[model samples]
Target: MILYIKYMVSLRCKMMVKEELKKLGLQFVVVDLGFVEILEDITPKQFEELRKNLAQSGLELLDDKKAILIQKIKNVIIELVHYTDEMPKVNYSDYISEKLNYDYTYLSNIFSEVKGITIQQFIINQKIERVKELLLYDELNLTEISYKLNYSSVAHLSNQFKKVTGLSPSFFKKLKEKRNRNLENI
Candidate 1:
């Protein structure tokens, strides 16, 4: 039996779900980002108990088909942006459509209707967040970060970063440094 779950984005979330399944005495074949496959069918009582337990932890057992598809879309984007070592060379629309096995137009319409933001905007936001993380790490230079994130050029990356954050990348890094310095003095 396959069960879909909402808000199961991170590795920690997967672990929590696995633990919950174990506690419920349910054997799962796989506990993935947005779904789990169980070795045996779950009884109604077991399903209710599992749902209640997951709800307590801010996770949800999803049954709605549209909701499930939306969660799948989110999981794909999250995995691509936050988990992958390298971004794909193809256009994001193609990549997303290929990954989800659905027409891009259909997926885009559904995601926009449900999320209130276009997938492109979501991708940009996620990219900006990744940029912030890299900046905070103090390891990669602007050029390196741009290339790593598959930006066309440093200027493009900088423009998008400024547009999203209202602060230039260098200034953002400076703010982090200043905060760290102040913390050390305390």
Candidate 2:
């Protein structure tokens, strides 16, 4: 049995889902981002119980095909920005189209209808979030972050960061440093 789950975006979420499945005594073949495969088929009663159990943890079981596809698109973008080490050589549209096996036009239309934003916008948002995360960690310099994220140049990265966040990357890094120092002083 395969289950499509919504809001399973992080490793922590995967762990929580796994724990819930174990508590329900379900045997899972895999617990991946936004999907779980079970070794055995579950009864509707068992499915309902699992659904309710997951809901308690802010996860949702997706039965609608459209919803499942939307979640998949989100997951793929999330993985690309936050998890993958190497960015694809091709552009995002080509990469996403290839990865999902859907024509870019259809995917774009459905995604915009459901998400109220273009896929490019979503990718930029996810990239900005990743930049924020990297800035917070303070392990990578602006140059390194820009390179890691496949931005053409540091100026471009800074421009996008300022555009999306209303703050320059250096300013953001300083603010994070200030917060960390304040915590340490406490």
Candidate 3:
């Protein structure tokens, strides 16, 4: 059985889900960001118990089909932004459509309606966050970060970063205050 989980954004979330499943004596074939595949059919009692426990940790078991699809989309974007170090050569719309097996128009409309933000905006936001992360590491220069994020040039990246963050990349890098957006809000 496959189960969709809400708010499972980070790698820590995957580990927590695995640990929770083990504690509940449920055997899962795999536990991922938005879904888990279990070895056995779950009883209602087990489901309720697991659901309650997950709720305590700011996670919810998702049952709605639309919500599940949205979560899956979010999972893909999160994986791309946080895990992959390289920018995709293809357009994000086509990449997402191919990955999700849905029309790009439908996906974009649904995502915007549900999340109140365009997919492009979400990608840009994630890219900015990644730039911040890379900057904080202090190992890579602006040019390197731009290349890694697939920006056409450092100037383009700086412009977008400033537009979204209201600070130049260098200024933001030096401020030292941590700013992060909520995953669901993104």
The lDDT, on a scale of 0 to 1, for candidate 1 is 0.94
lDDT for every model? Answer: 0.94, 0.93, 0.89
List per-candidate RMSD values in Å. 1.3, 1.1, 5.9
lDDT of 3 by residue, 1-186 (tens): 999999998889899999889988999998988899999998898898889989999999988888888888888888888788786899999989999999999999998999999999999998899999999888899999999889999999999999999999989876753443344356
* Candidate that beats the other on TM-score, 1 or 3, i.e. the better one: 1
Worst 10 residues of 2 by lDDT: 86-95
Candidate 2 segments exceeding 4 Å error: none
Ranking of all predicted structures according to TM-score, beginning with the best and ending with the worst = 2, 1, 3
TM-score quality measure for candidate 1: 0.94
Task: List model 2 lDDT by residue over 29-90, tens digit each.
Answer: 99999999999988889889989999998999999988998898998999999999978879
* Top candidate, metric lDDT: 1
Q: Which ten residues in a row have the lowest lDDT in candidate 1?
A: 74-83
What total of clashing residue pairs does each candidate reach?
0, 0, 0
Q: For residue 72, what is the lDDT in candidate 2? A: 87
Per-residue lDDT of model 1, residues 65-104, tens digit only: 9999999888888888888989999999999899989999
Give Cα distance to truth, residue 39, candidate 2, Å: 2.0
TM-score-best of 1 and 2: 2
